[model samples]
Target: MKKSIAVDMDGVIADTETHFLNWYEREYGVRIGVHEIQGREENEMFPDKTVARKFAFTPGFFRSLPVMTGAVEALKTLMKSYDVYIVSAAMEFPQSLPEKLEWLKEHFPFISWRNIIFCGDKSIIGTDYMIDDHIKNLDFFKGTTIMFHAFHNVNHNHHQRANNWDEVLKLLVK
Candidate 1:
């Protein structure tokens, strides 16, 4: 039987931070560099918490994000031997599920609808491997956890780290 891999969508596959930074600059005229994002909290990245929260609540923020580079090709390679599932904690954003689905349909048409799971909590997912950018999801995961590097998880050191999809492929596809 093939090993099952559960993948997180946000900071892992979707470059949400870049989306937020770009929007923040265009909308608020504030420039936030990767180095300036020193913490995990979204509000910590900005001088105004309200602005950060406001941006998150915006209608299309989650729906419109660039896919992380190399993620598609890496996933395609992994799918050859792994039962890959796109798992996301999307219930937190009431408006994101549909948009996320649409985004997935556009970028990852090869991923079947049956392989996607959008939920509030991810601890219930049992798989052989999991790649996520958040510690909250990876901590309870019942498998080998691969930490996809993101600004929030820069200091996280408990699991194996993959700085990019090329590193992820080196660690998992072998």
Candidate 2:
């Protein structure tokens, strides 16, 4: 069987939390702590369609987001061994998905659209390994979940906490 790897876009491949927090604060007029969003339910973070729609329409949201450290390098390494696919959550507005995808392409030209998989439920994708920052998704994947460490997730202990992409590459490639 061909080996496959599913990568999460927002947190794993890109440092989107910073942009998300900034956008949330600017739009909602309230500073949302990363910790508050980390373990909570998704609905609690984005309560209604209004909030979701606002996020989707936010200008330069994708362009402003930062790429995670060692993400590209790690992905390059994984690409050698497995079919790497970006299995991310679909945006509330489908149009927003393409923008986010374009942002990813601009940042990492090495990644192609054919390898990208945007969907709400990633568990159905059937990858041998999953690299994500969300603990909930990691739990759902039930594979060799490599938890890419972030500020909010740092406190939450996990079996596979990759401090950098080098470590993640090592784990996945081995």
Candidate 3:
């Protein structure tokens, strides 16, 4: 039996939090914290869906985002042993998920779309292990949850915490 690992995209594989924060601050003129940015409650921040859609459709959002340190290398290592699948929240804008995945592939060519899951509900996807940065998602998963720490999630206390992708790889391999 082949083991399966589910990986998150926004903060886990790609360091998109910074880019999102910058864009939010520039467009909304509000100095939002990283926690609020990743909270997934856009209604609290943006008054309407139009603004949210604008943010999602913004060109270069994918290109400007940076890959998380050691994410590509660690994924490569994990792929050697387990079936690694990327489970990410779909962008509100049309075609955003496909476009972003393409951009991500340019950076990490090892990942394929067949192994990617673009959905809002991650718990529905079956996987043996999960590496994510969100506390809510971690709580929803009933497997080995490795919390990837970020400035926003510094206060969250989980049984497993990985400061970087290398640490995550080490934990999974063990």
The TM-score leader among the candidates is 1
As for TM-score, the candidate ahead, 1 or 2, is: 1
For candidate 3, lDDT tens digit of each residue in 1-174?
A: 779998988778888666666777787798767656443553344445466456667777766677888888898899989999988877444456767778678987878878988887677867998888878788889788888876656767865999898788778786
Candidates in order have lDDT scores of 0.89, 0.74, 0.77
Cα displacement (angstroms), candidate 2, residue 19, comes to 2.1
Ranked by lDDT, the better of candidates 1 and 2 is 1
TM-score between model 1 and native = 0.95
State the displacement of the C-alpha of residue 1, model 1, in Å, after optimal TM-score superposition: 1.1
In model 2, the runs with Cα more than 4 Å from the true position are 21-57
Tens-digit lDDT track of model 1 for 8-27: 99988999889988988998
What digit string (tens of lDDT, one per residue) describes model 2 on residues 1-174?
Answer: 558888888777777666767777786788877766765444455545366446646766655678887788778878888888888886544766867777877887888888887787666767888888778778777668888876557667865898778888778776
Q: Which ten residues in a row have the lowest lDDT in candidate 2?
A: 40-49
Q: Highest lDDT, which number? A: 1
